[model samples]
Target: MAKRKPAFVLGAILLSLSFVVSACGGTGNGNSPASPGASATASATASASPSQAAEETAIPSASAAAEGTRSYETDKGVVEIPAKPQRIVTDYYGGELLAVGANVIGVEPTAFDNPFLKDLLANTQDVGYPTNVEKVLELQPDLIVVMYDDSYEALSKIAPTVHIPYGTATNIYETVELFGDLVGAPDKAEAFIAEFEKRAAEGRERLKGVVDENATFGIYELTDKGELWTFGDNAGRGGQALYNALKLKMPEKNSNDNQTLQLSMELLPEYAADYMFLTVYDPEKKGEALENLQASAVWSNLDAVKNNHLFMNDFDTFYRYDPIAITEQIDLFVDMIVERTEANKK
Candidate 1:
């Protein structure tokens, strides 16, 4: 009797098979719409062999289609996508895609540095900062998930494309749920959200007890040009985790601003809070920026600086709006607030 492969081995084999088909340009004919700009010259190799042509022309196998795909309405339009896509190419939000267990095959270079995603994406392809359509075609993605509309037309030529609005103040939980739905992991998405909410609530409670009830928090980043930029909930930038989920108070002046503000160093006191979270745009300029800021009596007098409550955060880790990163940020926030509050008491 022949022995059956273990589940993990079989899964790996299936994944390899999917990659092969995608790399060779299997478009899942029935499941995907006609390529908007697919050229005959580009697809000639995909149809070279009769067997390959038949495979490309035939509809997705009913079983595979039923088990692995569904139609989704996106900003671009309604489109069919694999239920559990084996080869995914994402422009931004690779963190959210990874959080939902999607098999990401490609992402922008920026995502390559993300601490949580870096190791996982070691073998993933760099699809270019603006996305190289030719490279994307070579990867043969089952789905192309993008945050920008600019790359949609080019990517749609290679495979099914879906657009999720990025740079909006969309709640992280809602975005996670949407990603879950897109990747066919709605249950997992909901579970993660529930866990996040529970943890956030716990963190908020902990902070309330350790810190002054009226104490406020602010997050800022120093640009390469030595400018200060304050973040808001418009995009996460740790704001959602701190101000929204953890219920950390923000200064009244900043409470209503939904977008990031570029403030001069002299105006630091106006937006200063009891505790400050800082990040740098360019690490090369960090030392100089810190030196310049510290040299200023104005910056020295701010409560956060005077109280020694300024915390420096990594740019890739803290600036992300994805659920995985947000959850991690929340954990860091709780620890910092608790430790600082305790130290201040001493």
Candidate 2:
């Protein structure tokens, strides 16, 4: 059995899912049973800053208010979202909301969702993965968000929808800023980034003291078809951030061949790298692809494999690229790899 590509490969699958537009109103006056936490009297006090006001134009079609944040008046309805939204509904990128001090109204069901969103989930509705417009409408979200292209249309119909377009090659920072401005939470966004940068700096400080900076890491997916799919700078995947943001090294053996290569199972041995990042095709289904890779002779024999340096990560969280999430993610990655690599040397 071959190894599957990185978790970002699911981007292709989600892209194939159907998307639709929705019908809605400007203000949701009548409360549904599942509506988000009511807008408190303090809701009117939520305002934006001067810098936030100046940059409001960049947010997608959203208009700035006197308070500094932006609002959207779409054909479906009007959304007076905060300059930085406090209540956020998401498909897979709900982690971004946490970074910005916002409350998570919903998230895609997954392990990452559980730890970060456990308390919020009790009251939050499951609009379903990629977002269910019907549930979104009932939830009366301040902002409806999705990470894939699949849920765009239906989400837009339900409310003021924002697409994160998560994948391997996507720039996480740019995606983060876009969301930041849209929700009128640029300050919170900036704060999260600062914290992330601090962690990244600490990682870099540690790395610079000892090992060679030019050392490379290889990311690949082993497939049943005997293929070795290597991810590159432009490849949309969660691991791509480690390269793009942290400036991590990539193995020389992993060439510029960013395309998913169909290798014979015999060649899986040749594709093994110094450090491997593992991902499965459809984790929602059978774990066969992953299991096969673990059991393969070629996989067991690799230097990285022998040393136990391969890193396993969550697909849904990693694949969705957002600035806040990206920083948080790479920090974790750097620490994990650095700790593992050092431990192996000992």
Candidate 3:
């Protein structure tokens, strides 16, 4: 008998899992749910200042609005949503809703493998993909929380739908807080947000002595087509935890807004950092690409590669933008950085 590798064990559990297009809408667009056009006036709101938005919409006690439906302003305009929705259908943020203990009766199957949502959603019905308006209607949900623009109208006909602009938020905490208000769990949301902040602060303090303040980090993904992709802000691929929560510095080109940037192999050096995390969607294709890059003089000369600071990240753990996933990402990132920094000292 041999000691089992932890990565192998984790990979075995996640090997059968399929990657969904991140609700935060990262690059490569392959796994994203299709959004057929529908005539709904509600659209995803543009990325607003989270602090300002939070100030405007204070989290009220769950009982404060318990009597009846209330008019809530959403990206789709002011629509009345149940003050305490019993049956909720969420296309993208099902895991986040379940984290706050919302009564989610239906969800997209893509979220089925989410470790955080595994037990909670075991009995929930699959409402097909986000584009399956007919399946969603059959569920007779009291509220529909959507992330895409085109699915709004069709679902709204079945129930009031709120559109949360995917990949637009600046921080995960703000998004969680907003979702809390939508699902009538403001207090729980706030409590989670506070806990996230406290943990992030503690991690930052703990890493100050381990990680160099000036050390820069870079995140990239290789698609099945062999293209390179980078993310920013609320976009997927752990941007919120690595750059925002942990306060790690990133290269200038990678520090832009909440959008994914595509890069060519020739331009790899421009975005290379003191540390790099590479994600691969298709093992065979991305593995070939990784091998080719390893042979390149340009890649060989990069600071991170030469210093052995490159890490391979899994899609399931690192690609999520929700609160529960973000918390996990923060811890993982801190541990990696601390371990690497300490190893370098020896």
Candidate 4:
């Protein structure tokens, strides 16, 4: 992926994640799901499409007839989708639409900086973040793709929105397929999933036996409160990807905070894990940010720190569930961690 400018543009992507944890994480993986069986639960609107595409420009929104056909099950509920849905609006989950050959009429603009979505961003309108219903409705989207949360109320006012809470997919490909079926773009979705799987398989082969598979890893974020907060299995960023996809280990004592924790600056050392993927709060404040975290004695004494196995990941890639960016980041992460760990043993 090409590097993004202003550097902080990437920060915007990472900052967008705070909303993901809050708006998306309600039904923990263990809970019984809410009923998607309600017909009133879905509403479909209409939007623009490419002339060259196989599907028509203005198909029905998912809300029109909830009884027709459902592509797949989702965290929010069953994603009853229209076959060949047109005029899709998405937030957070851009890659899903792209895979299914669905032309995006609009998506939350901030997700564009992901580099993977640059082309899509150029073609579609930016309706602000997921909950910015005013701008989204202006596009007249047939379906608004969103993570299920407090934002659902506002999105419902705009269109027949599909709410897929995060954590439905274990990896990038699974994520793509889950969303693709929801929008009736399964063929395109499967193609994208195939490409991602190929890349991941290649990466796994390259890194195999290079690092200890049993070694634990940690996913963390920098809060506006100026503290480094550690994330658990089902919470933020790499949470689901790490636990479900990579199958790596984690520290024994982990908390279940759907909300981002504010680990005070003094407790930086508490974040130590076998491998630490650091997400800085603000890239502009890097000098001071690194200094503050480094001042803690616990930070310096960690095994990963002493061996220099820590990775400073882009906020957008590490802190949120953007499938395209996450796949790229995972490959980069596997390569670095494996190389570093093997070098340490030597």
Candidate 5:
């Protein structure tokens, strides 16, 4: 998600259903749902402990099962979602929604852009970016999952709209379960979480031999503005796999930031690490970005660049940070690391 501007829009309270949305400011001891974790720009990783982490997935209070709907707690408020949501139109979390057996009929541009999702949702209709009120209403989603409140009031007229703020769930594990619970597929969520962790474990084992325990990794992106940005552990752009799954150490500067930090060409050499994954956001601006960096005597001379350690990646593929996206990213990154390491040995 390179400078991701979430476009999950259009939501409203459904008719004949009582949706208890979290009030702006609530009582200190009220039964208000927990505050949604902030976005990458302002949020820190408030990951709960293992036991607490499981609980933080947020337990939903059951209601009206006879009506084929359940009262579920969301980052925003208590939502009345269909027990088996047949037609879902969501924004950023489409990948997670699909994972939890959601029958997604429509999606926003962000979800439609995800490589895996693009193919899976190929037959689906696009709701457009910033979310068109007309398209969402036309799609006729039984459940509308949005991250922002922008279109809530407008879309509420058509469906049961639920808001789950972006970056609310800290990790893929919590994210999957949260959606699973929302769509009444907890069994699938648990199974997927267990399997996903297993995949991470296997990926970790593969790197143990080839990648040095202390090898530093960094995620670099060339922006449309012809700027360079380096991301840290939780900043997406494959950071989850690079830092979390593989446990690769990031540069000391980034290890602390754990988010994105801009770098001037002169300063990039200082931030370049043992391994770097570079993706250009817009190829049209690559000359001004990567080419200029390559021409920079100070930057090109850096060991990471000269040693062929800075691998250029496709922007669209690299920027999709959903669970499905991250799964594929892990394999690609591991192969790249192993290939680079083998070449270094020679």
Candidate 6:
């Protein structure tokens, strides 16, 4: 979400969360989620996909439409997908599949880079960016999950194609449970939820003293174009960890019912919080703009910034919010927040 014009680009590619969080708080075990979901009960319009805005119901799959396949309801149309998809190809939502123990044969190149899901996708084929449609056909996947409908006609002709859309996957657990139903893995989905909650609860205990009840947080990115990009809960950029899993809060003034907001830097004071997470977008390529801002008086004087409550995060590391991604994020995120806050206090 760097160098983006406010009205034009909502944000960047969301993050992928992949590490496993265990009930006993032991590290290891399992993996990543991405593409956001809905938990705020915000209107469908508020949670529309960043790229395409269509229906708000958000894609959902259900019971037998055919002898071997089931009906998956999407905003575009009802697709008949396999009751148990054996060969799956996903882009951002691959983490959701992994959480439910679904067999994902292929994913876009980005999924392979996801630390949380990378090991799990060790053997998974790289489907290419813009989703190499040709590579997908060769993979002979039984089902395809996408964030958009651009290749719907082509992909659907080859096999059942379901659109989950971006921004719509904000409700992390709800969306994962829905994916479990979509893949006929309800039991696995339940277990994912159980373990994630247990782990997150443990994380909350860690933040008890560091984060108080009224403390507010903000997920922000200083775009190269001089815009302030703000994100909602579970909308990636560590949102799942800070706002959802650890149960932190975003300032109501800057927060809205939707997934993103790109506003002027002058509004920083209004959006200021007790603590802040700031990302420089794609720093290597677009960091000059942020450097200029950091030198400005406005940037130096923000409440959070002056108070040493500002923390930096890489754009890609914190973009994913799948069950797997969020689970992996808890311990790491908790430790980072605690360590950073403690250091600043000293």
Q: Specify the highest-lDDT model's number.
A: 6
lDDT of 2 by residue, 231-266 (tens): 554343344346555667766644433324345557
Residue 267 miss distance in model 4 (angstroms)? 6.9
Q: 68-166 in candidate 6: lDDT tens per residue?
A: 876788987888888877778876567777766677877877777666776567668987767788989999988998875767788888888888765
Backbone clash pairs for candidate 5 read 11-152, 12-156
lDDT score, candidate 4 = 0.53
- In model 1, the worst 10-residue window by lDDT is 19-28
Q: What TM-score would candidate 1 get against the native?
A: 0.75
Encode model 4's per-residue lDDT on 22-54: one tens digit a residue: 112111333212212211211111111211121
Clashing residue pairs, backbone N/CA/C < 3 A, model 1: 68-83, 69-83
TM-score: which candidate is best? 6
Predictions in order: lDDT: 0.62, 0.49, 0.62, 0.53, 0.60, 0.64
TM-score per model over all chains: 0.75, 0.63, 0.76, 0.66, 0.77, 0.78
Candidate 5: tens digits of C-alpha lDDT, residues 135-164 = 988888878987667888887778888887
Q: Determine the C-alpha RMSD for candidate 2 after optimal superposition of all C-alphas.
A: 11.1
Single out the weakest 10-residue window by summed lDDT for candidate 2.
Answer: 19-28
Error of 4 at 125 (Å): 1.0
lDDT (Cα) of model 1: 0.62
Model 5 regions lying over 4 Å from their true place:
1-67, 74-76, 256-258, 283-286
> By summed lDDT, which 10 consecutive residues of candidate 6 come out lowest?
19-28
lDDT of 2: 0.49
lDDT of 1 by residue, 222-256 (tens): 66567676765533457767876787788767742
Candidate 2: stretches off by over 4 Å? 1-8, 11-87, 110-123, 147-158, 162-169, 223-228, 233-241, 253-272, 281-301, 306-325
